[model samples]
Target: MNTKFEELEIKLETKQAISDLGLIDLTPIQALAIPKMIDGLDFIAEAQTGTGKTFAFAIPIIEKIKLVKETQSLVLCPTRELAIQVYNEFLKLVKYQKDILVAPIVGGESYERQFTALKKKPHIIIGTPGRIIDHLNRGTIDFSKLTQLTFDEADEMLKMGFKEDLEAILQNAPKERQTTLFSATIPQEIKRIAKEYQNNSSIIKAESETLTATKIIQNYYVVKKEDKMKLLERLLDISNMDSNIIFANTKREVDEITEFLREKKFNANSLHGDMKQKERSYVTSNFRNKQLNILVATDVAARGLDIKNVGLVINYDYPQEDEIYVHRIGRTGRAGSEGLAYTLLTPRTEHKIKQLEKFTKTTINKLEIPSEKIITKALENKLIISLKKEVVANTNTYDKIINEFEQEGISKDALLNALLDKLVPSKKVYEVIEEPKQKKSNLSDFDNKKKDRKDSNRKPSKLKDNAVLVKVNLGRKDKITPLIILDMFGSIYNIRNNNIGDIKHYQTYTVVELSSKGHSFINNKTFKYKGKNIKIEEV
Candidate 1:
């Protein structure tokens, strides 16, 4: 059992602030770790995400921090987003503690602003490892008086290749200070950090009975890597998601998915660690405000985001760890509302679902990719329902206009056909997309696509016959194979590896033959390789 916030040995202001946030009882990690950390003992905590580990460490930092402000506490995080989020939480909890100042030091923000904030001698420094290390080297930060130290998400920091920076930062900090390292999982490197850096510390695990939310209908699709995007678009169109999140593993993937969705006329944007704070704030605000309906993001949005009312989550790429999977899906199905999570898996990664299922202690139901016809029928049903709602509205003016059209020999059936044609799309969005079994998009897709089109000296081959042949700038000189060209087509256009017939590569361009069925895959629409516009024209 955990004690109430009022019972904790803390200042009246701190207690009042915690109470104001509607937090009555302490979380398991807080009850276990706070008392130990407040006692000035080095501690190692293994806790799951969203288990109140923030408050666990924050409460102790507030209780033990002195009024004399010269950087008394330092908390290092893996990413700028987490650092900013933690800083915001402290800002709220310390609302009544007027004199105790805190500052966030993260990359992608102005150094002059950080220099100004550091000159104020803030009592708490919440920052990413890289920025903190830079400030330390610039002599702008004085951790000599650091009385308390914490490595929040220690596992992530190490995974981000920040071990050297961590060692350097730890070395510069006062050895006599109280230290605590908190992580969702305890890997060997995290254990090594605890052993090498801290005094004798005790381990505390805050495991939950269930790893994920029961309200989330978790499902995995064993789709090929090339077909993931096609299936993603189909699901979004038919599922009717509101403010949904699409998670990808890399920043490049984030950009690619967001770009692809936008090209297909979905209201979507990308979020990742590489974005500036203002850029991130804008994207999140738009998402939270419902101005943007779909958010294509990296795992940076998973850890500490406060956005609510997510209707669905789609993992464009599966994470290697169960913790990342939990956090990714945790963005949805919050506050008792039901949500759906769909994970796309390739043949090689199909077994990882078993691993995630074992770790989460829940069955991950297998999902089938809905065919194009089914998705179109579902969308048409929605259109019919929406149009039926108009039957109740007063239509005297429209009826008179229709009467005139009837007099002009246009049948009511003809009018209905016109409305249907105008209201619904003529073809499925995935018609031009190639669903494939193997091959993936390159990291430099956007740049390479544009460069190959714009800067190349090659010209389009003249049509010798009505045969379907498309000429592209990438050829032998670009170090591309026939399979590579087919994969590129598979990634964007709706064709398969078998659909591509003969491939003749020259120094400047490659001419590819498409079977008669795949000829319709060529389009003049602004197709996006990765947010940039490209086109495939018929020869």
Candidate 2:
């Protein structure tokens, strides 16, 4: 336990709640941000996953909250799952202060239920920006009494294109209110928002080493993009773990991976934003209960989830940003437990491995796929364990079947061999992926230095086999966001929202991942959105 926590002079109620949770020491971010936030100064904190940023804000907010429950604090998150997570964290922190009720209002959930919750007069309401905007428009929410306003994952909210909604909410907020923002990265947009909406704010960050997932054992194997599934199959076949998460870059890929794994007899499910609330709940519950061994998800959909005991994390698709790479691997190695993470890199993405290493400040060792001998040995060991279980007084159940086989002149040895043939899969060669015989001078740099010029609106360049980075000529300057782009495509071309991969926004324009599904249709032409013709070019 750190003596600094005692110095904060936290209330007994919140302290007891913390003790009950077995939280003896404060994380660095919590230690710094908690004290400042509790002091009622506007604040900005740069925090990463697994860094205890939620508790940093929750602790201070809970301590200063009024007991009467008139909406003293409001937290806005980027996704329904994250909003719910913050709500639950608040509940835990205020366990002793029963008067401090908390509620979650997010999209994809029934508004009537939230309205009923609001009527109870929760002391704090955590919600997504859109739903909160809806409530504000309806005059159902009362921020007149709100003293503390927070934006968790502020960077993500901007990425999802909630700048206008956030701004509108800020415009309606009390100027004297204490404002706070926490994000994994402090982009220029975040800085601009702080300047516009917050008073002079103190910035806080932990030591650089504390921000990355250094505890997890990390490795990667370079493979042709087409051979990724073969590597995944080999990993699953040889792994001794109970549950794992396979992260993809897009929802379409999530479903594809899930479907492929299911066909291979692996218990897997897909989790993404497109799934209904109930469907997501069902998938998450089964995963937590160990009914599902593998979960394939995209970054946005996997946010704020706290599933435990995950033994391995697979980056099936290379993440688009450094923060995303850290977040994906941070799913494991939680709670001081040992965990392993693997990345499958293609020639186009192999460069990202170096960037990942630089960002995490750790070595990512090269991992070779299991050799045939190792695979066979693992399979034999698995079979032996099963045979051991069956040999222990289960013969009575097989008596009838054995007699039938004997009458058919099928010996026990032959029957067992046939069973083995069905249970064990045939071996195939996984092509060895060798690094380029020639390396570039900047091969070790992780920061993406070569960027398409904003003015370089030339024709689309040749992309990797199935993915294209298309630049759209509308960005934050034009009040553009990913949702607007998605909506335009959905309405105009009958395109599914998930067909595109990660949507990266710039000041004057945006870059979108046109995967095979999208590449087949996007004509590199112009389309009008909001009365302006938006042109797209290949980058």
Number of the predicted model whose lDDT against the real structure is largest: 2
State the lDDT of candidate 1 residue by residue for 237-327, as single tens digits: 8788777999997788999988888889999998887787788889988988999999888775555667887999998887746799888
lDDT by residue for model 2 (1-539), tens: 46445566889988888888888888889988888888898878999988888999999888888778588888999998888888888889888988778889898898899889888778888999999999999988888888899999999998877877999889887888899999999987788788888888778887778755657999888777777887788787777578999999878889999988898888999999889889998998899899988999989888988688889999997777778878888888888888898888765556667667887898999876677678778877887887789789584668799999999999999998998898775665554534434245453332233322111222232234577677777886787766787887678767675567567666567978766766655567887877998887676
- Give per-model TM-scores: 0.70, 0.77
Give, for candidate 2, the lowest lDDT window spanning 10 residues. Answer: 451-460
Q: What are the per-model numbers of colliding residue pairs?
A: 6, 2
The number of residue pairs in model 2 that clash at the backbone is 2
> For candidate 2, what is the TM-score?
0.77
lDDT of 2 at 132: 92
Candidate 2: C-alpha lDDT: 0.81
RMSD of candidate 2 to the truth, in angstroms, is 9.3
State each model's CA lDDT, in order: 0.79, 0.81
Top candidate on TM-score is 2
